[model samples]
Target chain A: MTASTAGPFDTERTRSVRGASWTAFRAMLLRDFTILDKRLPQFVAGTVMQPLMLVFVLTNLFPRIGQAVGGGGGASRFSSLLMAGIVAQTIIFIGIFSVGTEMVRELGVTGEVEDRILAPTPIFVVAAEKIVSGGLQALFGAMVVFPIGAFVPSTPVYLEVRPIVLLTLTPLACVTAAALGLTMGARFSPGTASYLFGVVALPLSFLGAIFYTWPSLDAVPLLQYALLVNPLVYASEGFRAALVAGEPHLSLFVVYPAMIVSAVVFTVLGMRGLRERVLS
Target chain B: MFLVPRLQQTPGWLSRPDISILRPRMHSLPPANISRPGGTVTLASEGESAGNGATPHPGAADVISTTALKKVYPGGMVAVDELSLSVRRGEIFGLLGPNGAGKSTTVGMLTTRVIPTSGSAVVNGIDVVAEPARAKQVIGVVSQANTLDQGLNVWENLYFHGRYFGMSAQASRAATNDLLERFRLADKKTAEVEALSGGMARRLMVARALLHQPAVIFLDEPTVGLDPQSRIALWEVLGELQDEGQTVLVTTHRMEEADEHCDRLAIMDHGRIKAVDTPAGLKARLGGGASVTVRADGEIEKLASQLRRAVFTTEVQVVDGHVRISLPQAEGAMQLVLAAAQAGRFRLTDLAVSCDNLETVFVKLTGKDLRE
Candidate 1:
């Protein structure tokens, strides 16, 4: 409409993708944290309630009523055994609910996923950011185990800290859970995701070695081998090795490699599934 | 796999006098009844060029071009057939069509949302399918649906978008603040995105798209849910964007808006472009004619026969309960029509005349009105 129109574009901004993806990844992760910052209370409540309440009721209440757990040490031994399981399962659940369920919701009718799909980065980078952010949330959820393990059980529950194993297993466990969540988010539609939670959640918690070590399931040998197929079994065994190493648990060899394999496999599956879901 | 060169290969388009000659000749149609009555609608020059005078960025480079693009869903639904289009930088181009005419599909292919089953689309010198990430860097899209991050407040939405474009935190914050001020959204910076009114939300979206200064912006049916006031406000912003040399592509069924705002419009139907030209150029194809329509209380076909011999009637056609008469120009055609009607003993109720416009062009090309 004007003869003296100005080319308003600021093309001087460095046109580059070489440094773009990393910054985008960090910013996307920060976006999740920004939302998480507001929902901190809800997140804390949702994350800690199930694991802590499970620990208190089983270790504190059950002993009071003489319907105790554990082989010999009764309250104390069961409390220590239960601590690692709770930490492991809580980490995995955080990943499932935070990354998996959130993915399902964003990808559903709301189409919130569309907001990030065009981030000037590879779609997989966007997907990987979800896993990392979810892993971070799962890490915070795992911390809830320490305080609950310390104070909630009427009996003294000792969580011996093996610094090396704890630090390594912590990230590995969190990432594996988040990666599995990514896969679930990609797999389930809104209508069936709830049903998936119902069918999958109970089995994962109960058969997951959450209340007992996988070694003890030797009394039920068929069940012990079958539990190997569950990803959470490796996380629990790894945590038990980290927190209750003096007790009977799976070997450090089996725990580390099994968890590593699970992390790698789920990450690959999750990334591919996410790509299929979004690109079509 | 149809690769369209940036400009080297488009000799057919470049050699044409103007964009109007990029034209596909009007689709063939069954002849409508016409009678000259006593004399032809005459005493007027027929070769005058388009008069609305929209100048789409002379000598500007192509910001977007698509050639032989096509998409077929897995279930065998062809959303967009082989379609070719070009948009110039600093021009506001409109894709005008009714629902399911493949406007959105075409936009989707260009925006990197919908994958094409075949053919090529390039945006800002990047092939969209092959280098989508680079293409995405230059193009911003405002989708028809509300895809804002409902979880974040308005300010955070713009802030994070800047960050996603690789801006530093401080820079992102600064850009977000400036955009909020420009769009008159500074007061509502902290408001939840879902809580903003329709106009505010749309403005926020446009701001978010511009935060990184993308080369082109695509708005798919941008005014669909907006009220008249909001619609005008949005167009005002678009006009300003055009003056600043921002290329825009909007898809809509609204004829008047397209005519008023777009530098050029590509009329599309049934998954292909029916015509593409400046609004004035498309309407000019109807000649320097004016059309008059009259509703009557008698056999319509009988009135059509009577009007065929009217002194100034150039063409006559019956449509949707009214008889329409076309004239070289509307001067004195109304009285002649009325006089001819009276002599034939047909009672006329009322009549209206309009200069040939986009709607008439659309109907003439597609055989149906746009509102459908």
Candidate 2:
């Protein structure tokens, strides 16, 4: 049959395993992006809502109500300080929802509803492709949320942008966050997804150092050290190193390696969890 | 040529895969027997090379083959046991069994979803165990659930599947349109998958499975939830597949459906095959060999043992408070029934003569009715 019909993948290069796998991998990515494009409104709504609320309340509404933040850095410097933090928070949240919740629905404990896993590629590529897709969505979330954080304040937000740092640290932050989401998605079944918000997302949102720098938590010494376990803290700190260049955030030296390690760990765990769910 | 599946575990797969994984391994495989238990002229072994790991391939006659295939879940439940099957190209083969008879597990093993606990399955010359991804390139599957991409509309479902199988965008779109038209789903191309009826959704799934022109298509309970009209439509599509020379493996508990559509059938129970033969062959094997079932007022076993010797019956057994007597043929069957009844002291509460059919054959072999 193959001899009679030359498929799109019938060329000499494509007949090779590596070339065929690459072709299928790219096609899977194309499918992800195509769906994302078709549902642009939903993607925008999911990406923009939380950051829009955070920037509005903390920078715009808080000062008008006479609330003080950033230890009297004043509302404007406080805006600048929280800007990178909001970028980090937005990317992380978008990453989780874009990848995690959808996965829970697709690989639900009852049965697999996702047919994408049956793609003619190695099984692991399916999980890897999702992580990559989610990370890309998170990056877009960062772009959408940054302007809201930068310009929404009542006062002129003090700001600086380091192009190289932003470009370099942003991808690491996005993928780490996405990989974390994949781990949670794969670990929990559909029935226990509420615990995702209660146990996982709640801690990630509150203790993620979005409103205050990690150094500011020195007053609560135990809590300060405890938040180190959260991958989001590094994302927040890494963005601070990029957007607010000279702010009091965690060292970039520490942030880079920590995020990389977290991304690697989550990728392994998430892929294993998905495989175990399907292959068993 | 495809790499061994074990190598995919490395991170290098995400980057440039090593050329070493692309090298193909070839072996002169020996043919295998398509056998049945009890050696009753069904499933006779063709070549007696049992454990040589030289199981049959798709090249010679069968387009799909399995040798001693088994799947034991982690919890110690044996789902499929020592299953060997051979399916020729262009034929619709069936696995007919009640629920939990391991029919789905066996299909799962063949399709690359469930890894085998032992044994091997090869599809179109590819060893499913050693290179599942490559094996997937040759096989298509329609799972029991409606696995249409909820994210994509009906057309995009087929289009994306084509793309996933390495079709170019133009090719994917063309094939998608062609399949939608063929399945008579062209009008519903833009509709969301959630909006589709049970039958329309199933036809769309079958369309998607065929878009890439896979060598074998596996459909699990294809007509279970469909209406009669929809079932006819699906069967028409299967008939078209036969014309296209596509090998089909379907599983269903509907005896009549299997009897009418499948070229060969394997009746499975308790994770093992009770029989494998053409529907006509199966019926003929038991043809004219009707059974006389007697529910006696006295001890069933005692009456059963006495009747086994007194009556010129082929076989006799006591089951469910009744003694069943099998006759060699339809002629003189009445005299034997009368004789068996007299030996039981004419205390028959209820007596029945089962006609020869797939269900009867299933009941006679397993001592259990197919419909509970």
Candidate 3:
């Protein structure tokens, strides 16, 4: 039998790795957004309700009922602080909660995630698609929270909004939060995911320096330094520096670098966790 | 080629040479050669001469080849053990085994869903363990469970799957429509997967897998829960795919399905293959005769022993409330057994004679029913 020079198999159907990865990424992102679009009412309600309630009760109802947060001129000052903080908190919670819960469902015994994993792309790209889609939702969550925080409170709120800073810092904050969500989502089981709100989300909000400025916690220096571990703290401080000026807060140099570092760290960890979980 | 040693002693009915024992070492064959008659190429290893005897041609390039592929889960549970097999291009190959037989694990390893603990698996010439993403490009997998996106319609599922393989929007849409029609799901294109019936969902899963036109398609129990009509329909589809030169590797517990659909099959049990051959070849290994089943009220063990000693009987076993005997010729053996029974005063309540097939071979080899 003479050896044949023809190729072992046809290559027409095979795809370039780079092209396939890009296509798979776009398809995954589109799938998530399509689902979100179908569930828009639920999305809006879930994203808007918590932040609105927080602003209404803490900023508006508290002072109206003669229970001012701080002291003289303190209610209005606290309102502005609450406004920026609520936006930051809303973004973080939406990122972590949304991605983590969805991941729990996807990684279950009978999961549709199997289809996604079969795509002709590296597993890390699948993880990244989840994070990017989650981040986009977080950005939307921030937008929804902003208007509610601006008008719902009874106090006349004063804000100094910087367009460039807001645009730059908001995306960074959302990405970091979403990356953290990806990591937690891969790490936790569905049964354990519910505990995330109580154990992680609630504590993050309180210790995130949302109720007061990071520098203003000078009276409690240890708590201030410890709260630095929370990514939400950087988000709150970044928004405070942008929307409320002359307030004691972390400088832009610290906030921006910290947010960038956190985003990178969480993203790396999340991808690794996702790969392990999927391949195991 | 490797030759399995023959049994030292044989009954009169089982005097045929065991040709099925010789397994071809296709992995050691020379690279792709010119297609010979029968679309096969004969390549000899160092220890064997090419023209010494008739060897089945290694037809087409191997689509999937695994050597000593092993997977050990945490806590040291071995899912697949030293599994070495080769699936040729453009053939319907069946992996036959009962539940918990590691068929799923082998599929998982080859499909890149579960990582192997040691050794290697190559799918469509790409090493699955080393480059799973690339391997995935050439293979489509339809898992046993329903994996269709519940949130999306049938068309969207196919479209997204095509896009994942890097197809353009126009191409994806065209492929989706074509596959929907081919799978008889065009009417359900806009219907959510959650609303589809069990058979429709299964068909949709297959349509989704074929969207990218993969070289090899793995179907894990494709008809596990389908009705008889659905199973027949799926069988026709699989036959068409094979005719179109699509290499299909399927895992199924149904002996009838394997016999009807697979070009060749490997019977796997306890993470190991007991035998591999065509359905007819494997059946021939079990004495190549007819089976006589006698259900009597007397001592079944004594009757089986007596039948085993008969000149025409090759083997006898009592199972499921009947004494099954294998004989070279059913006509003569049945008369002789009936005369002997009448002479011995052994009353027979029922008797049946049928040709030996894959199920008989499976029972003879594994000593258990296929369903068990």
Candidate 4:
């Protein structure tokens, strides 16, 4: 039959043809997981292994050298601080490596970005989905770190587990980490991103306030200020502030607000960067 | 030779509400204001150029428009100038140009892939830039790069695309089954895309583009890396799409493809459209009905200049060993061409003349080879 005769079309067909926003969002998430599902093991080892090893080495080896250093009390204190810092490090590593690397691969050699770009959903949403997925990976990393940090060397940094603090901040920290990942992924070309882990990421980790308290770096005053630039400082401080509240070492007041602010700022900047990059 | 599409029978339009016309702010322009240079139409306007209501669909020979389309790179490269062009709905519109001439860029803009620099276009009254989501619903895009998913089987790919377009899984599978049988992909339904040869992959890509039943399908160098057999297969698929009452916009540097397959095309250069027309229209506008080439032993230019003054010759030039000339008609002019060659004291080594195809018209307008 001729096409002219083929239709007794309804006027509502246009409206009926719409894709569900949530369905579209879910489809994107499902597709990404399907594609990367095989790589989950790699993510787990990458996230969990480093934190466990760092906790072991710092908690065990450092206490012995404390006497000669004359800052032995500070060393033990530094070790506890370092445990929180290690958790933050795991989050950063997972965020940067997992989401950032996948994005580079998607936008670059594979041309998979086309699938995401052409979808009915906005590009920022797709980037956010990846960021969210990476956040899940960071959460998994934190779960592993909590048990190890609490149990190692038997002097638990105890008694102040504010369920509210733990619940609220863990998700926030993961999101912040993911947002930072998305920002890096969206902004850098894959060629530039090739060096992300070795160069950009490592330096950010060292200066991220992970290993030491922000106020304690007065010995190297410039270093103290410089560390403030890193997002990890906020994350670790937040985690420590929540997990070990009222501890003699750190204050919760500074950590909570700072982390929240950083997460909000990075999320906005990252999402904007993603939109601009994709639309371009 | 035109391969008449099996599906070429015109489809009846169902009386639907003028959904677009209800908007009080749509851009309106007179029919004549649409520019068709060298026979191809471009909607190159800034502010509301997209008209409201059920105007003639671009394939119907009436209107092709774009609205407020802009594509600005993060690194800040303006690939497409804020440009618009419109074609009378049914006329074959050709977009012609050299590599990086923004032919692909314009195609990208029109297909809703790369956003326009700052303006939008409407293909058959579908707002391409402003309502790209709506626009894409009616457009099929075959990018310059191959977009066929390599992991899926051929039928699976078609089925998935159909589902992606909002068809129910059952309906999509049914349609996919039919298409697979029709495209001869039924036998290859279980075979992975990577296993297919180059020709098969190209065919599959065309199949995937059509699965959604888009109104206007864009082909960006569909035959770029294909062997002759593969290219011919792609042409057949395109011919079929056109036959099915679908408007097709194809971008290619292959003059022959544009000349033969395209109903009309625009010649593009340096991010601006140089000319737009049917292959025949472009040739006629280039000062010759069509071009013919002849090879003579010595003094080719002298023979060329002599042919230039002849009554039958419109324009003539000698390049390499060949004397190229445009004649008023390809049939009768050959005798005149030979006579002129003989009278000029130039011996014809080899001579051939045919209707002026896209090659001559493109070179004449762009001052560059079409293949380049």
Ranking by DockQ: 3, 2, 1, 4
Task: State which candidate, 1 or 4, has the greater DockQ.
Answer: 1
- For candidate 3, write residues B1-372 as lDDT tens digits: 211121111112122333123222233334433242322321211111122212232455567778788889999988788887767766788998777778999999999989999988988667889888877887898988898887778889988887777776777787787778888999999998889988898888887887776768999999989999888888888887776566799999899989887877777777777666666656655436777888887888877777776644667889987888878754476786787666667799998888767777777766664444
B1-372 in candidate 1: lDDT tens per residue? Answer: 111122111323323333223221111111120121211111111222323434455435456777788999899988788887767666798998878888888988898878899999977667889877767777788888778898899999999998888776776787788778878899999999889988888888888887776778999899989999999999998887776567799998899999999988888877887776688767765434687898888898888888897653558999998998878765677887888888888899988877767888777766764443
lDDT of 2 by residue, A4-95 (tens): 11111222222445555777778778878988999999899878888888888888998899887657577777788789889998888876
Error of 1 at B296 (Å): 14
What's candidate 2's DockQ score?
A: 0.32
Give residue B124's error in model 1 in angstroms.
0.8
TM-score of 2: 0.81
- Which ranges of candidate 2 are over 4 A from the true structure? A1-14, A109-113, B1-60, B287-354, B369-372
Q: A72 in model 2: Cα distance from truth in Å?
A: 2.9
Q: Model 4's CAPRI class? A: incorrect
The TM-score of the first chain in every model comes to: 0.93, 0.91, 0.95, 0.83
- lDDT of prediction 1: 0.78
Which residue segments of model 3 deviate by more than 4 Å? Answer: A1-7, A71-73, B1-58, B286-289, B293-311, B314-325, B328-351, B363-372
Better of 1 and 4 by TM-score: 1
lDDT of each: 0.78, 0.75, 0.78, 0.62
Best by DockQ: 3
Q: How well is candidate 4 docked (DockQ)?
A: 0.09
TM-score for each predicted model, relative to the true structure: 0.83, 0.81, 0.83, 0.73
lDDT of 2 at A209: 85
In candidate 1, position B86 carries an lDDT of 66
Q: After superposition, how far is residue B359 of candidate 2 from its true place, in Å?
A: 0.7
Cα-lDDT of candidate 4 = 0.62
